[model samples]
Target: MFGKKSRYYGLATVRNTDRQGRIVQAVKLRRLPAAGGVETVVTDGSQLDVMSEHQYRDGARFWHIADANSELEAGELVETTGRVINVPKR
Candidate 1:
């Protein structure tokens, strides 16, 4: 159900029962990797995808930055201007 480049691709899935008592299959939670990255300052109106494009030449690779900093929500990385964020080295 996921593309080859998707982070969830090849991950194990588990059957889960929701409150309605229906069985649902869900991808296993992916753990954040212990990554070392360079510290980058968030510029005005900075965005994760844009930063990813600038750094990795692929906007879809924004997850690398998020995972590097252990942030579940990637947007959190660019929310504050001038804030220092970790950008994973490619």
Candidate 2:
């Protein structure tokens, strides 16, 4: 379960059986809102969580940055140093 401030918070979870016939609960997909943001250059050792904390004051919101930049993985987004990334406005 996600925290109150999490993007996935309060999303409906549906029960389903996987190919292996195991029951699982999955969160429903939710569309992200379109928003404008500013670009910032990442330095060596830069991390998405730190960047999120700096920009949004919530490290758990790093996915916002990833989503804004079309990155499906946070590691993929922050692994490259000196890369320009979008920091979405709250």
Candidate 3:
């Protein structure tokens, strides 16, 4: 289960039988919203949390930016210097 502030917090949990005949419990896939936002370059040594703090005022909300940009692996957003990423509006 996720915390109240987690992106997955309010998602529905589903139970499914896996190919191995095991029951698996998992949260449903979270759909990304269509957001209009500003683009920012990933500066050297910059992290998503830092960017989130500047944009959303809550570092834990970095997923908001990641979700807006359809990033499955958030770390990839900052893996390269000068890479541009979308920062969702508050």
Tens digits of per-residue lDDT for model 3, 7-61: 5788999999999999999998776668899989989998989989998889988
Put the candidates in TM-score order, highest first. 3, 1, 2
Better of 1 and 3 by TM-score: 3
Quote each prediction's TM-score. Answer: 0.75, 0.66, 0.76
Alpha-carbon lDDT of model 1: 0.86
lDDT of 1 by residue, 1-90 (tens): 689987788999999899999999988877766777889999889998988999899998998898888557788888888989899889
Candidate lDDT values, in order: 0.86, 0.83, 0.86
Lowest-lDDT window of 10 residues in candidate 3? 26-35
Better of 1 and 2 by TM-score: 1
C-alpha RMSD (angstroms) for model 3:
2.3
Give the true-structure RMSD of model 2: 2.8
lDDT of candidate 3 at residue 30, scale 0 to 100: 71
Q: What is the lDDT of residue 23 in candidate 3?
A: 95
| Model 2 misplaced regions, further than 4 Å | 1-6
lDDT per residue as tens, model 2, 1-90: 889987678999889999999998878755677668988888888998998999899998888888887666678877788888888988
RMSD list, candidates in order: 2.2, 2.8, 2.3
